[model samples]
Target chain A: MTSPVLTVENLAKRFPTGRSGVFVNAVNGVDLTIAPGETLGMVGESGSGKSTIGRAVLRLTEPTEGKIIFDGRDITKIPEGQMRPLRRDMQMVFQDPWSALNPRMRIGDLIAEPMKLHLGLSKSERENKTVDLANRVHLRPEFLRRHSSDLSGGQLQRVCIARAIATNPKLIVLDEPTSSLDLSVRAEILDLLNEIREQTHAAMLFISHDLGTVKLISDRIVVLYLGSVVESARTDELFSNPAHPYSQSLLSAHLPADPAAKLERHVLKGEIPSPINLPSGCTFRTRCPVAKDFCEHEVPKPHHIGSAEHQANCLRIPDGGNRIAQTETA
Target chain B: MSLLEVENLRTHFISRDIDNQIRVAKALNDVSFRLEAGKVLGFVGETGAGKSLTAQSICGLLRPPARIVGGSVLFDGQDLIEMPQEELNALRGDQIAMVVQNPRTSLDPLTRIGDQLVRIHQAHTGGPVTASRGRALDMMQAVGIPDPANRSNAWPHELSGGMAQRVLIAMALMNNPKLLIADEPTTGLDVTVQAQILDLMKGLTERFGMAMIIITHDLGIVAHYSDEIAVMFAGTIVESGPVREVFAKPDHPYTRSLIASTPEKLQIGGGAKLGGQPPDLYNLPSGCPLRTRCTFAEDVCATPPTRKQIGGGHYSVCHFSGALPEGGGPQ
Candidate 1:
């Protein structure tokens, strides 16, 4: 088997609250791997710590605990100076494209900054490559001269993608890249990302709250609840037969684009609990439809469902009680 | 009879630019639609397409720098456009109700949840506070807020996002509004909570016999919840028709592109043209709003095109609406 491009083990992050010495346990123990050129989608609602995981994986936010191995190197506690050289192989595209980029810098310099800093490319070479990157990401060469405020959301996102791919990074973490753009423009961006995946063969950690968009691009899926991985499986398998109660509820909640499609909505009982004071055992128990007394006392371990690759963290899996019934009948 | 009939609604943002010159943005031009009671009409558009502006225009919620300069919003027998300030104020929270995105902001942080509900009823009907309180409790239960009697006293900040939205819906229902405008109602809620809220809305529209206009950019929510769909571009209804007809056979280029772009229908490498340049309200190009991005655009497109009806209430605002290429296939 080929070595994975990224591996995260026992990943956790605790954010310190003001003066109280109390912490918001944003992420719990999470383990996952992304192979070279593989797209792993991480889906969760707000406060699910999915975004925290993405940032922590890149060391943009320091991980309180866990190990993040990039390209077969354990860089968990690596110094900022040492990580600066390693930054060339890892890039991130932020959610709000407008705020992600520097407003003062022209698009040309924004896209060229990475290449210049990492590869030590000359001004002439960087200029030529900036145009090449722009064309590759479907951004017109003329817009490169404009500031971010002067461009549209889709165009600005393309510039963000251009910057991310400029250094030929091995891993790119996109945090809700398309969530901020319009629907039609989102499709165009997804198409561009798909094309780049083929050409660059970069492993992507596509983190989004929208399941439909994730299903469109991801090879595998990981569902998170209160920062812990509840289920991880092949995209097709997970969609067709989700083994976790949370996964089942999430899949059912997704409103399909087609009007005629029958929706069996399993609207969960309550809002997601606050992350500041998470649930004791199963963080999802408070909202899980089939949660029992045992669920409150036990942190269900990942149990292999049909195959080893498809696993769900639910004790009800063995008893066939994992699936939640469709309440919103057609 | 249609509960709400909006005709040639022209709303503009009359503002001054950074340079201090007066800039008039034609935000909504010739927007028209007829909605019957108990039916849901979904408005699908990108940002700045003026979905919320149209709602504001209909509800008389427009503030200075933005005004309804043309057309009429006739609700039932009376023309809302010409209505007096007092009459419009009385009608707003009663017959015409609006629930916007971010329920927390729409709610009064100072008032208790129950009082907020009762206050809407009292504001419109002017009944005894006791009667209003009784109705408020009933509405709290009606909108699916648990323990209506106790939850009534809960502070607005204490309620979760889903609970807050339900409270907003309950507040809208207190006066038994004839028309409800939910602008991006379930946007910020969790996916699961969104479904619950949408289902609640659907049931409420039927039970109360209200005409609902759901203004949202999510095609998925619109597809399932709405009976009719209006596709807006550059602040105009580019295409509109029954949901089934529009989804099955999109006529306008913009609508076609919209449906083709859905994750369910999009072909990965098909390279469907994304939206064109952002709508420039200040200096809109003459002719169709979508002309800038349309692949079928020609010299004839230089002339503004009127809405052409294909069949079954299906209408497209383009010279060659039905003749455009059918969307969604591996090309």
Candidate 2:
């Protein structure tokens, strides 16, 4: 394939808290890379720091440590004034459509604003391209005449996609873009994203909490626990045989749509420890059933599960003791 | 007899638009269903399909600008709609309880969890303060709240999200109600926590022998936990049947589209026609609400269709129920 469009190495980010020395430590040493047209899926629960990684990759939020190299250049600490030109090649779409969109602006202008600023097109030229962009996202041109208030959640998301691609960016970070929408509308949006991915060949970092939806679009999947990467593998590999115990519990917890699907559930017992006071060694040790005394004293790094693409972080991986028994049948 | 029966339930929103024109949004039209004692019925639909409105209407929770223009809600041989406000008020908190989406907002922040539970019980069936407090502790333990003796004193703000939801369920069960309606009870919850809460709800319903109506947009929840399923569209129950029958052989066009949209069943780029935007409430089309997006629409669709019963108590409102191809018609 072509050279990777984005490479993030050992990225770490910490947000300051009210107290003097303590920090949220949202993202801790995340490593990821996306090929020119590949999609990387990041799945984690609240405070797992998946969203922070997305923002850090785009440099929307300044990072505390690690390197971010995009398209052959290191952009970990690029100055905001000089980063303006680079904005044309990177874009992001957030979860809530109502807040992401400008309610005061007309739909046509909202879609055209990005192109108008980035491409510097004339009035008629931008109008022609706006209509074309709307058509590309399967939005009818008539709806463009209305404001954001008149559109439904699905329609508003389409407008956001149209704006994101109007610049023809090399990378796009989508953070739970479809989580707020209904099921049918989510399918339609996923279809639209697949179509655009083929046409533009933009590398995408898809971050969401729903594993089922993430499996639909991502080529590779990364499992996170308490702001740290626990497992990374190919889409099918990760779903079929996840190595980490946290990943195992998450997959078994999902309820399949078919009523006849048998459930082997492993409901974790205690609550996730607050992010402010993460566990000392392996952050997941407190809740992990298979954890032993050694797990609390030593941190585990990435160990190969099968190949270069499949890896997980666990002390038990070396001893082949990471498997946790499915506890109950529902 | 069905524990709860809602027949021809019609609710409309009549309000003056900014232009001062009288407009009526037909929010709920001809919604009817039945629930057996100790059985769970799951409601699945899009955002504006009136799933929650049906629950609110049955409990007499409608406010101004929204009125129950037609129909009756029969619970335990009494019509909830025709009853007086005083009688309904007594029946509501005593016999029927509702748990809404946001657990934090639904709970009172200033009150301790134990006091709130005891107060609800005392309001319905008056007893000595110590007796009510004992009952509160029993319910907290039953709902899987760990260390019920100590956690009872924690206020709403002190409890975690999942813990708060458990307290809400315990409150609903305090009065030994005949029916419980939980609207999107676990929507904002984490997946692992969601499993724990759903399991607790199912266990409690069976133990108490009380009927339940679970209103949610997630089909997975309905498929796994519910005994029956009702698929709603455009403020109407387009299909209702045993969960197995409906999922295996969905008859209505709208139901077929919805089931196919689930991530487990859906094949991306399969070209399955998933076209549906909930109809314009103010001016819904005259005939079939789904005809606009239905690929099999014909001249006959201009006229309304009645409910057609397939085998095993499965019902569908379509002219050609069970006539579509496997992947749906004419995508």
Each prediction's TM-score against the native?
0.97, 0.98
Per-residue lDDT tens digits for candidate 1, residues B1-331, read: 5889999999998988899999999999999999998899999988899999999998888999899899988899789999999999989889888889999999999999888888888777886899999999998889888888999999999999899999998999888998999999999988989988998999999898998999999999999999999999888999999999998888887787788888888888775565567668999989876777777888889899998999799999999867766663212
In order, the B-chain TM-scores come to 0.96, 0.98
Tens digits of per-residue lDDT for model 1, A124-163: 9999999999999988899888899999888999999999
DockQ of structure 1: 0.80
- For model 1 chain A, give the 10-residue run with minimal summed lDDT: A321-330
Candidate 1: deviation at residue B121, Å? 1.7
Place model 2 in a CAPRI quality band: medium
- Per-residue lDDT value at B49 in model 2: 96
Candidate 1, which segments miss by more than 4 Å at Cα?
Answer: A19-21, B16-22, B328-331
| lDDT tens digits, residue span B214-266, model 2 | 99999999999999999999999999999998999888888888888899977
Interface root-mean-square deviation, each candidate: 1.1, 0.9
Candidate 2 matches the true fold with a TM-score of: 0.98
Candidate 2 wrongly placed segments (more than 4 Å): none
